[model samples]
Target: MNTMTLWHITPAEFAVLAFAALLVGFSKTAVSGANTVSLAIFAAVLPARESTGVLLPILIVGDVLAVLTYRRHAHWPTLWRLFPAVGAGVVLGTVFLLWADDEIVRTSIGAILLLMAAVTVWRRRTAEKEEDPDEVTTRAGRAKARSYGVLGGFTTMVANAGGPVMSMYLLSAGFRKLGFLGTSAFFFLIVNVSKVPFSAGLGLIDGPSLLLDAALAVFVVPGALLGKWAVNRINQRLFEQLVIAATVVGGVQLLVR
Candidate 1:
């Protein structure tokens, strides 16, 4: 977990991962769906399965920074409704991880990311016609939450690709920008922390990954600071479009990589 223990990466790969970590923090605070760029970069820089393990800790650091900054605006009811389905989905993802080969993992994850990115774009276009405040109390709303939550949990557990799924869900539910970020921050911090045990159990995380995570964690601070500064200046609609665009690009990279 120190400088001496860190190995298995070139200077270039380390630089790439560090920049990806910065994107993790920036995506957490400024753009809701842009973390797919970091996900694709991590998967590109490391072994596909190992990348998921390495990136989890760095994501938690970003999540922590996000929650600290936006805790007050979180909509807890939506979080509460999503937890059960998400937990089930996480367990399913763990099962898949334990049995799948590296190729299977890569192809499945790549496909899922691409599909989710497409879905996010479609939802953004249709969001204007959806009802306001699609809370999860009603049966229809609960079904919607369950669907998105399960997808979010599985994708997140498998490839750290849940941001766009949740972004689409929240946008469809009529949350303003701050509320969306706050809820997402809380959701990911708790969920990513919970995945640690499962990841270690699957042998996906270990000493090497931890050391790598430690080295990348430092870059998150500046990324977070810049995100906090930039969020207010960016056009919210434009930012969302950029995020979806980045998600699509990342998905394609993963697919073709």
Candidate 2:
């Protein structure tokens, strides 16, 4: 594959990428999972494999903004428990990417997004019936964290599509809006930053890709600020609904495209 320079992107493609970058920022601050749409958009607008690389830096920028905004509300114990499993999953995903082609990457991401959406819906329904929804002390709870951690790391490594997976886990664990945003903010910031070396090693992060990222990054700032303003007005139920709806839409778009 050739290095993707700024000149390679037409004006229309730049418009689409800019919009996707804005969504990246908005998803970070308001609806944590909603950036699946941005993922799909980027994949559609660029090469599927290359898109993941381009999207990573934008996501990291959003992660920084999110940490600055919601850092105080993070759940440290939960993050600690999940990191080891997530690291393993990242390794698995990296191995998978070593040989996978563009079609495989795109299909896997689409399928993962759809499956996560379904699981989240089911989990939410079952969570209402649990005796202690907020506790993660049971054997089942520990297993669930490991499960989500692995899946989150894998999807994120492959397609930058881990947001919905973590969102599902947090919601199922009974987090409120602030806690959800804050915890996820820290989780993604740390995880996305950690992936930088791996992505660079894979030749996914390079000069031309970074050039494109530099152009699109400015749009993220305004989108994040807008998200900060909007998040305050959005109720919890509506927030969760938007996240799920975005995930489904992104999945369908990726599959059909």
Candidate 3:
């Protein structure tokens, strides 16, 4: 059998799929920004149009794990405050997904990522003199929070590509280790749950997708375990630097491709 009967996936492609899923699990539980690489890997390994569909269910599974692990640490008030704007953004993204071209949508997502990364880097550098990297207090915190919320909702809805966007926002907000992890867990739990309806509506999480997700999910466990161990070993400064660098690279790849 050619294996096309099994979701059109081959043994060679299966390895790539596993790697991508492992990254998703790892990023979800650990880095939060590394999922972009997973996304890129999926899109590259599968047809771009079908890739998102296949990845959605796997992401939902990972989201469940992340929420469970970090449930106690979330900042619920912040989550509520961001919900309305995020909801609006999701609606907008659904509308776009319904009517937009695939390449256009992907390219736009890339550009947005690039722009967001640039802004994040600029803010960090310009604030170096007066800013305490660990201090969460800042004049622009609220405004930044709101902007990040809207952007996060939009990008995630459009591409499942909002991790870095929110990561930067939270980092800028000075959320330390547990808070950062918890806030992210809650944020994604809500966001991913919300996307289920959207993904179903878009036919991105049907039978084939679910099967693919199941096969790929096996890799997530190890990745998440690895991430949990890795996080404790890395400090805040190093973490932020890695995140920024990852975002920049992800953005560039999306744009350049």
* Candidate 3, RMSD to the unseen true structure: 3.2
Per residue, candidate 3 scores C-alpha lDDT tens digits across 124-146 of 77775433334434556556666
Per-residue lDDT tens digits for candidate 2, residues 1-257, read 34644458889989999999998899999998888888888887787787899899999999999999999999888899889989998999999999998788778878887888898788778765633434658898889899989999998999888898888788777778898999999999999999999999998888888988999999999889989999999999998898888888877877888
- For candidate 1, give the lDDT: 0.82
Cα lDDT, model 1, residue 170: 80
For TM-score, the strongest prediction is 2
Q: Which predicted model would earn the best lDDT?
A: 2
Off by over 4 Å in 2: 4-6, 129-134
Per-model C-alpha lDDT, please? Answer: 0.82, 0.88, 0.77
In candidate 1, position 166 carries an lDDT of: 81
Predictions ranked by lDDT, top down?
A: 2, 1, 3
The TM-score values for the models, in the order shown, are 0.92, 0.95, 0.90
